[model samples]
Target: MIGRTRLAVDIGGTFTDLVLSLPDRTLSTKLLTTHDAPDEAVIVGTRAILAEADIDGSALDLVIHGTTLATNALIERKGARTALITTAGFRDSLEIAYEHRFEQYDLYMERPAPLVERDLRLEVPERLAADGSVLLPLDEAALRRLADVLRAQRIEALAISFLHSYINPAHEQRARDLIAAAMPELAITLSSDVCREIREYERTSTTVANAYVLPLMSRYLGRMREGLAGIGVTCPLLLMMSSGGICTVETATRFPVRLVESGPAGGVILARRVAALGGYDRALSFDMGGTTAKITLIDDFMPQQSRHFEVARAYRFAKGSGIPVRVPVIDMVEIGAGGGSIGRVDPLRRIAVGPDSAGSDPGPACYGRGGTAATVTDADVVLGRIDPSRFAGGKIALHPALAHDAVLTDVGLKLAMTTDEAARGIVEIVDENMASAARVHAVENGKDTAGRTLIAFGGAAPLHAVRLAQKLGIGRVVIPVDAGVGSAHGFLDAPIAYEVARTFLVRLDGLDQALIDALFADMRAEAEPVVRLGVPTGELAETRTAFMRYRGQGHEIAVPLDNAALQPDTLRQAFETTYTQLFGRIIPRLEIEAVTWTLGLSEPHVLPRPDQVAAPAAAAVVIDTGRMVEAATGETVDAAIFARTALRSGATLLGPAAIVESGTTTIVPSGFAARVGYGGEIIIEEKMA
Candidate 1:
């Protein structure tokens, strides 16, 4: 008999991908993203996939979803009309972020405008010390007076972030109660609830961002649930979070800020799984969809994670050019180098690719949806890298002539070159862009890409994977099954999990084990309920980490803590080890202090290991051959084409070649060879000289 049936849905900038996993086989589909009603495409796609699988929606055991809606809201500034309430004299914290210019040399640099306008940033007379002691009592009368002003401004959401609320929630909680009583209809977000950390600006920014998107996310979640039920999918609907975990809809709705990187997080999860299955100790995950390409490094089958990341950068994709949110997130670098990224010639007569995209509505010029600009897709079609008839499984027909015209007009004529040369230049520039991003990201993490295998996925990644690998000095690339919808597949592999972070500063020598134990107990009390809502019967796994740094230092490093016991000496040793690993040395005389504590609770999951395959004695038969431009040389070459489904385990083929599938195509470049693994994944490796 078949076991549980699951469906995973991912909504990206240009496409909505769905994966339906059955006991015997898996089915997948892709649809253009419906910007106006994002859920409409999902509902329709769900019905179609279910019908194709010969199953009903009622047969689904679970449904997991991840979307870029929240991130888009912040990027486009299309969220609700929100107001902020802060302690007196700190109303400018959002504007006074870091108090230093992120780009010191660029005189024309601009900072991202705060989500809450200055006038909407109201203040009340209340104060709290660093130790959670009350310096001045709450002025309820002053807070009440702001209600009229908020009403006059027609505020849809409110954010309350008082000074030092991370240490004690009394004032923030009381303020929330009072506000709820007066303005029951307003959506309010509390800093203590969203981000309980030390930095004043980051905490306030996180709270305000949460408030800004609360109403919109709440309504969207409700509509999604209703829409799913309307199609007879009454199973539990879980949501993918930025931390590579799936949580119940209720938990996700309450903390929608955690969903900003949800879609890309799923891709990392899938990469981690692929790394483990392929027995790769180090890997680089490359996910290139329609609008952006996300690159992440994986060590020991774990993706690099962070407690803080900026969003919606306003100045040249600089670090401090966006709003900072303090939450658990997978660390990665996203660049605008996807299939639909626009290509243009600058005034200097140089080729430039994007941090912008022509999303599905107009898409690429080849899509024939009214777009006139040359995009990466247009370049690919013009270069013969993509088959116009087989694009998107024939759901959408592509116009090669339109692609050639767009490329010639936008880049060729400007550069005084032919259509093929301009297209190749566009592709080469975008690949170099991605390569530079990967190199920088790896160096920033104190790692190198020399020995790491590239795990390529998403709709556009496979077409450019080998070239990217060659640029990074990587010898191997693994294109897993269902690469086009890899992130959606990852949703099915995620564990039900939740994480809680708290700020508690103390010297290592003065750390109180009893107090720390109580603190952890409280944090567990906070996170367990959230995890249990999604998984009730499984044994929960726990992980602990402390953000430690030298006394009086401005930064910290994460040190893993043991779940068994807490000892001062052990803590010091762990901190020193982690600190030394990062900086190559640690100060011996300075005392270390713990600034933040994090507790993660997740349901345990056991992954089935892939079976090993032996070497093949025979070469795979060629299905067909097509002409394509070789990456190593600028000359056109005849490349063999094979059906992925027809290639069995241990089957091998030489390049240049294309392995075609319904959802995506894997391109094996001129100097590489391809092989089929036990799990039906295509492994491409460089040819020996």
Candidate 2:
């Protein structure tokens, strides 16, 4: 039997990464992203990679892909013209989000505008109670009248989210049928279908988000498939989801909202595997690409998961300042801090890194692609941290003079400092920004950063990994093989899976075995077909979880359940145990109630062994490279440079060293020591004083 040949592709804001895993070896490449037409880069890169490997696309058995297109559409408000259909009295639900200001003290605080305008937000006479009871009949005549309005408004997509539809989706379903019958070409989404849980605002937001991006994602997926077919590749193509799982392209098209964090989620999956392989119980995953940086916390080899997240924050990246979308996602904090992040002197003459990026079209000042703004990459180049001759493995040349001029003009002159000082300040500010974000994320998750191992990857992460680790009080850092295209590699490791969540409120003490059993049965039935599409002949793994809380509490915590039949006493004990873990104590005499149930089905995954290192060497050898500025201090230092391909297992190099690879470079700052682990990982730790 021949091992499978798989291909994985990850599309970031500024680059499209491809990884081809043959039976014996893996080939990888990185290309600048084509923002106007993302699939263009995918096709071009795919063809180039295949040609280099001397194989046709037909040699591939499977293809997996993850992209940031859907996320960018939501953040830039570039999706289709969408409308929302809701109950008569709830036309303004989106605009009236949370009914309170996310930034209370700021008088000029502005909430994100709803995707659907008030003029296009049509309503009908229909209502359902919280417990799936019908309060009012559907007004067919009114809905039929609204179809003409929709046509006149030229809406490209529609979102149907009737009141209380999470419990009873009859009204929403009927509305969709009627609208689809009238206009078969229009894309339609239902809150019940996308988010079958409580919280009216979140449900509607999710459905609207789905409808908003449906047309764009559908067309892109279809075109991508056709392109692959043109290259003689007819393999099954799976999409990475925000929840760190893979699903067929069909599911992704139907629920594009789930792909918002797909690209970043792959990095988290890779971190989990690394965590498990290295036996690191607590690890922090850091991914920094060209346009954004993402931080995820992992515990016990599992990245934290969430059912809700916001997009396009309008105020200081505060919670509740962006549009909320409810979906199963690997919880992470993302900020606009990347290689292309622009640097500027704020009003106080203090250096400020970004929440804005240059992206690929204009790139950074060093790319010499018509970009003049001072960016983090430009700073790195000015500081001599990146080799102008070796960036992107010599695919693209960097102009040091351009980097120096841009940084000098933008930051140096403004701050009355030398170009080198300004460059150092820029790198320092960006590093601090990422470190602060990681710290805040940890605190929010009831954890701290001191004792965790930092796993860094992506295009820019390895460049600043040691500095970031030091700032977080971390002593250990690991850079896995192929760290630059880490997310693409992660795509190859994802499992075929689907998850179903539904609202089923009931007190643990009043839990009826039959009712709970039926609920899970239905959820399992729904997820089975989705998972089977990818794995047709196997016993799928199953997991059950319930969202439980003390009665009258505003939020709930997830409690895992066994496969056996539900029992009130057993469920109560489980709930209490989970609650205590999260809160450090359980509420005495408080009744525990289950509000939501989730069922996940996936193909069992057997983790592969860590990357193989080269033959062990008798002793470490170091070669001094040219001088470069140490980021930790403002002084120049002589750094040893080693090609990653040349290093053998058990090799060690002292601080002020650079490990260069095809895709990225790992910089070991002063006071740090780098060792080649047995698993081909670059393990950097702080040396004892």
Candidate 3:
């Protein structure tokens, strides 16, 4: 009975989506997000989905959730009042970030505002060497004095970051114990336990971010659990991770910092799976939601992973302009181009789309949500691309007149252009913004956009995929059935997984076997319980990796560890091989050292195999008798609007057509054709000349 039902939820800036899976059917619903109380949207959406599916909450086997709350909290500066406790001379480390300007050429470029001001950052005298050797012991009296200062200042949470804490952590641990003994109610985060990396600024910034959001995330998660239990849903809730894995609620609440990019990671997972289904090994995932558009590259069915990501960039596309968090995250580029992105005309009379959005409360002009600003969606409606009566599966009717009036008054009349021209300009500007982001991301990763097929998803992706693909010179596009709720659907395909990282400094010359074994064992032990919470007994697999580099290098690369017990020499050879593969050559004289080790456990599940699919009947051209419209060149073209549910496998249709489904809409341009594949995915392939 428990295996008969499952639930997945994804919370975005403008919408919260819920999906319920029964044995034979899936039901989904979308609701406006409640920013004031984030869990309220989850409760409402979950109830609606379960009711529509005719299932009781008690029968659910699993609940997977992803949300933007943590990311929003950091961006809006709405986290808890937090203080930092650090070694004496390092009090200014968080404030004084890497002393490099993000924009070297601009004379007036401003740096990102520090999260924690100087007054709140208290110092305790302690030091540790880079090799885990204790230099100056932590002073309990000094810690207590700092604790008193924090208490007097009414700090709600505290972060403990010490010099060389990733290597030793003894001083940070002792400081945490002392702080907890003194202040029982204050939440605490230790840098060594959270990140366990070597960069001082990045590690401390990550710890501070965790501490700042700890209280808020803890309270929200606790309330959500209680609410779900009150409704008789006794199943354990798991959360998606930024590293493209899933972990238990306890793990999420303990390390909420890792959830910052979780939602976008889900979209990447969907794109990768869709790519494999369509027989494309190299693909670009393009997701344009209500507040942002994320672009990620995938090869061999895996999204790229990175150990560093920045948020709230002062310069939109600059790398070093924001707070750096060193965690395992899927590598992607996020730009502020989305449905709710506001469009305006600059003083030079050039049209510009957003780095600012009219969020759910005051959505685009056509939503009737009290917004007066023109947005991308409003532009689409005015350009005759979106049907007002059929938007969002007819759930919300849009007003075209309001969109026209907003654009004409704000942008059109001033620029001496017609309303349609202004709307087209807005669409073109956003498309170029997204294209520029994709180009930059590919260049940074040593990839070429022309060689990768575009896998488009998210609420606004289908509306613009054709134009976007054309801009990038990409030859093919694949739009899945549930593109609007793609991230939520991706949750169903995720395996139950967890990753544990710990610092165990080992110089390759020394080769400490006993220490290496103990460190790996500790990491595995820490990761097992979290993995077991989602997976049943005796059905789990694990992967081991060590972060290694040359002796004096600034960064490290992840090397795979063999499942069999590692002999010292064998391990050294493995490291040498991995180093060469990553850097093209190994260091001739310097030794290789491992600074950190990670162990990941996952209960693997098989996705539906596409290669095993039986080909359907010979494709037949079906004429759509609904309506005719211009899709691309503004020339009248016969377009068919077909119901996606009625199209079976092998059903083919030519372009300029609109495929409408319950959750999303796909528009095929004039030069392409679509066919339903074996697994019910809509595959859009470009026609040859």
For candidate 3, write residues 1-689 as lDDT tens digits: 13457898999998888878788988787777899998998998888787787777898888889988888888888999999999999999997898888899999999887778889988988888888788888888989888889989999989999998887888988899989999999999999889887789999999999998889999988988988887778997889888888888888888999998888888888888888777788899998888999999888777877778997677877889987888878899999999999999988989989989987878989998788899998987876667677777788768888898888877899898888878878888999999999998887665678967888888888888878988888878888767888888787777777777877767777877777778778888877888887666876777888888888888787778977775667767888886665556777777878887888788875544446666585444443443433434655455677777777887888888787765667778788888887767777878778
* Clash pairs, model 3 backbone: none
Looking at model 1, the pairs that clash are: none
What is the model-wide C-alpha lDDT for candidate 1? 0.91
Worst window of 10 by summed lDDT in candidate 2: 610-619
Clashes of each: 0, 0, 0
For model 2, how does the per-residue alpha-carbon lDDT over 333-368 read when each residue is reduced to its tens digit? 998899999999999989998878999978998898
TM-score of each: 0.98, 0.97, 0.93
RMSD in order of candidates? 1.5, 1.8, 2.7
Q: How do the residues 1-689 of candidate 1 rate in per-residue lDDT, one tens digit apiece?
A: 11489999999999999999998889999999999889999999999999999998999999999999999999999899999999999999989999888899998988889999899999999999999999998899888888889889999999999999999889989988888888899999999999999999999999999999889999999999999999899999999999998899898888899999999999999999899898887999999999999999999888998999888889646889999999999999999899999999998999999978999989999999999999999988887778887787888899999999999999999999999899999999999999999999988777898878999999999999999999999989999998999999888899889999999998989989998999899999999999999877767989899999999999888888889677889999999888877777889899989999999999986655655756465457788788888655678988888877788888888888888877778999887888888777889998889
Candidate 2 residue runs with Cα over 4 Å from true position: 1-3, 608-615, 618-624
TM-score of 2: 0.97
> Which model is ahead, 1 or 2, in terms of lDDT?
1
The per-model lDDT (C-alpha) reads 0.91, 0.90, 0.83
